[model samples]
Target: MASAARPQGFTDDIVQRRVHRQRDQFLQCITKEKVLAIASSRRPGLSCDYFKDPERGSYNLCCFVAFEDGQRWVIRIPLAPCLAWGARSKLEREIATMQFIADKATIPLPKVYAYQLGDGLDPLSSFVILEYVDGRPLSATEVDSLSVDERARLYELLADVYIQLRRHIPFHRLFDDLEGLRPSEIQARYGQRGVLSSATEYTTMLLNLSDNALSNTRSRILDQEQGDDVLYHHHLFRRFVKEDWLDKRLDDGPFVRVHGDLQPFNCMVDERMEITSVLDWEWSRVVPVQYFQPPLWFTGHSTEFLALGYPYLRYLERLDEFLRIMRELEVQKYGDDLLSQEWEHQKSSGGFLVANALENWTDIDRFSTRHINRVWFRGTKDAPKRIETFIREDPTRRDLVERLCRAHEIYKKELQQLDGTSDPGDSATTPDPFPRRPFFGTWESSVPGIITTTLALGSLIIAITFGVWKKRNL
Candidate 1:
């Protein structure tokens, strides 16, 4: 399709400023010839313009290149010498993975317009051109502005996206190759005894976070002085999912071909609130489900979905939306009963396990400060006086705490049992599979644009919900 022209408020000069200021950093990595080619090839009718992305800290610099012809593209140019080696490889893998997903056309993913390596600019100055998806990010805004319907719709959309990808993508096997390490092998290398059990060791290793910051940082957000306590919360969340039967049975319980980074920033929407495109696959990975699940650190409260970011509101909503879409697609492909059973299994086995795994989250101290005080307390308003009394030093709340602890324990036990039955070393380990054909065409056609028109509607619905809730509750 031809590019749309720039909007009136967005002047060419303004666009140029945005490009050099934010997008030029990435462009700086490319050669003068390559830049000229990209710039010269600018579609005459394109509407969007290119601007550097200041938010990224990775190898590739991102430029928002939009043309007068309405061609909005997020061009990525790698700064490293080797595109497929070391940290740069991570970005390469992510691009490959996203390209793979985009070809499927199953969900709303931004289309990959063009990609090339060996440009002779930098040793590794590879570049990828992608569709410029429209819509404001859900994460950038406040929740109170969203309505109930929007919240529900957002959840529905999120579920659709997750289900589509999960059904088609064998995440575990992908990670095995991408990381060049098998699940059992990883466990053996990292596993420890005692204070660090099998699961705990794995969590520590795979969290992808530095040890000193999490374990030794001076920050005292949680009442507990120990970093392990903080790590424990993350540990519990991951373990809950990893130990579940449904996840284990699929391949590696913890791993999948996930959006690896399905944060709000990656998603795009149209004016109708539909999902227009899911951008940025640089963080895509075949990692553990816990790694992909939204960050659910609250003890008892629910925050507005957008603010929770990854593996929290966004993750859950994404997963939820994916499943819904998968059900429809599966029902069309196979039959309704098969999908029904799958959903049942997920909810009863893995989904229930997820809830159970989160049981420990109610321990007030384990929750992050935002979730603990704001979300948790707000959710338990009915029992606020009693809860408050307990917080103030009453011993009775200890039992409630114990109950939360016990629930967490039971959930943890279930996960352990799920894990015990499966051996990562088993011969029948799942094989990693890739699509045989190029995602779009025989490698000649431009990948179709991924624009979910529903996201705007979803966001608007949430804004409405917030208003209604505030009016009624206040």
Candidate 2:
């Protein structure tokens, strides 16, 4: 009998459901005795009632332990499957980042009491015990409803945090430690970890997604041996990857340690509107200073507000004011020249905006037209000419030109179908067809499996091509 067919695409629902099951199993394994033991270590002779919080993050399960003395603590467990490729390293880094911030900065952050890096034997074995912060997340309504004074105060507080964070300089050699560990030790400690050393490395990782997509398509084409579908997909991704102008701008930078996922949801504010704790440090990395200029959540709202009938113009106005205050504060502390230098780069190349868009692509409402056009076709009316130049640079890539043109037509048709319009040209202002909701879902869920498959194929091709070139030269 034939085996059951595997699903072709990774669905958001499937990922979420699987993650949910893992969370449940982990929770079930955490007995009352274990919670009591963890809590008693912090507070001697303490017994507490523990319950899972309804509010859970994508990568963590939160369990609240209430002591008889009315004190509370949170037990956070890392959901392994929910994490991307390197779960162990990410978990360790997060612990290190939190500890570093707690020691070095005055920024509000949860104090970790104890943690266990679980071996894969048991689901609930890994856990982090932290002081339960008393505050709620800043809601979207609050963001939209904040008065001028409140917003100004919030921005100032955030700026202070950034200033303090900047004082803690990144390692000279990317993720290397100040302890002077050996190269092998460093590799074992940090290699394949999420910590990036430079802006160029970050950009390459982002662009490599497209390269991988193309590779996958090429492989599938070779495997089945006769499909234009994969070739057309490859052309589209290749065009995106070959945006050399944008690539060049990302290569220059003054690197700094960044809170890689600093958004409204990751921050907790008290009823009095003060930031209580900044949570989730898993995505933190060393990156260019310009990357920290635009607020992650603000830039992510470029098209989202338009879809929700919110006044995007008002949003932009508030955003400008927020940025202006932050810049003035940065200038005052770091001197006019240091801050101005980064701002100049941002204005000259539009690199800051492009970088912000790239990092927050998953949150972006319209990925293709808004992000791709804004970055690659900025100030230029002749985007086709730029694409033609890319094609002309390599005779081997010339075959992709027609395929790319054909892919664009297909893309237009897909857009038209989503917009319910017969004329694709007239539907430019339509709402985003692929809005990623519930923010926790992986980008892989939204993207088709074929894209991932193409990426693997592309890597293989590069390796083979390099081998051939070396053989010929030798």
Candidate 3:
């Protein structure tokens, strides 16, 4: 007998169909009719027939169920084998966390109607029933057509959410109880389940998470040079943390729950200059205040382009404006503006780099390119030379890097085997930090520079040819 094959990812049409099929299955017992049975469980006698088309995200597939009683609810079905601690457990945690936030914080969140309870939801044991938020996600190109003032107001609204998540959440009581959980379980849920004594402990836990993410081969596409990146990345993060460049007096106290993926995509905004509801609470966790910074959507591009020019410059202007809004909101709310005090480091280059270290630890190549290659060395052109100089220039840094390399490689290999991946035979692996991009193959990240250089060379050739033609005519 042959076993069924697994999906490459949820992106495939077949996998998406299966997800839709699963939602359909939840509607009824194929053998029996349970259409009303499902809705009644959420709310007694609330009949539902029309289900909106499924909306898919990286981790979950959601379908909006509209009841005849003018009620709408969403069924969030977890994609199994989901990244980090499996899908079922992660979804359960998200449900618990969302419930906690809704009760404690004044933030607008979708209510969880039925999860891990009720025999009516037996078919959807793997899914959660949530209240459907009415609004559009700001990242859905809806905010682009907004007027300048509208955009400013939008940033202010977003800053309010950030302030609410940090300020209003009753995390102190939760931390005091600590869930009666073991230190490992506590650490699993929150970064500093115990109070972080120093920067090293905090950053080391970040690296550990990155290593765990890498150990899971399913989290990323198999890159041959993946292991090489850890040496430089781990070294730079630690060194910067030790110096005042990163984690400056920010650890040891007052850790709060951060909306881990606090971007426009996860935030739903209405036309009335109000943020209706914030979504994607799965990755949210309690961490040091410094980890929470301005959202990435403010950067204006997918890749973090620290280089000056078209989009990066716009990001700087928007970022300052956003921070100004946050400062004002903090003052009004707490009268202390303590949250603004920590973000002073966030405006620095070291802050952004260290931030990438904490957040993008799972994706080391991205951290290297955006934080180190782009920001530190300027661009791809100077990356190799600058990186070599950086490692070799300082003896202490060099020793630290060597230790990181050995540790990263050994752990990566052990985890690789655990992921059922054999040695990739990467003896021929190049020291190149950045991998081959999709469209351009080996094309440089500096596209504007390439275009400008091409035009300059074309002009030079035309001048030389014209001069030769004049000499021949003479």
Candidate of highest lDDT: 3
Can you tell me which runs of candidate 1 are displaced by over 4 Å?
1-37, 41-60, 67-70, 78-88, 118-124, 139-153, 171-255, 288-334, 337-474
Candidate 3, poorest ten consecutive residues by summed lDDT: 454-463
lDDT of 2: 0.49
Q: Output the lDDT of residue 1, model 3.
A: 8
Poorest 10 consecutive residues by lDDT, candidate 2:
456-465
What TM-score, computed on C-alpha atoms, does each candidate reach?
0.47, 0.64, 0.64
Give the alpha carbon lDDT tens digit for every residue of 368-473 in model 3.
4555555555666755555566656767555544454465466557554544545333121222222223321111111111111101100000001122222331
* Model 1 per-residue lDDT tens digits across residues 160-254: 67655655654322222212112233335532311122223334444322222122222222232222233333443444334433243333443
- Angstrom error at residue 274, model 3: 2.8
Query: Which scores better on lDDT, 1 or 2?
Result: 2
Q: What's the residue-level lDDT of 125 in candidate 1?
A: 46
Q: Compared with the true structure, what per-residue lDDT tens digits does model 2 show for residues 57-176? A: 545656678888887787776656554422444456667777666767788888777776656746456777778887776654466577878878887877677766665554443442
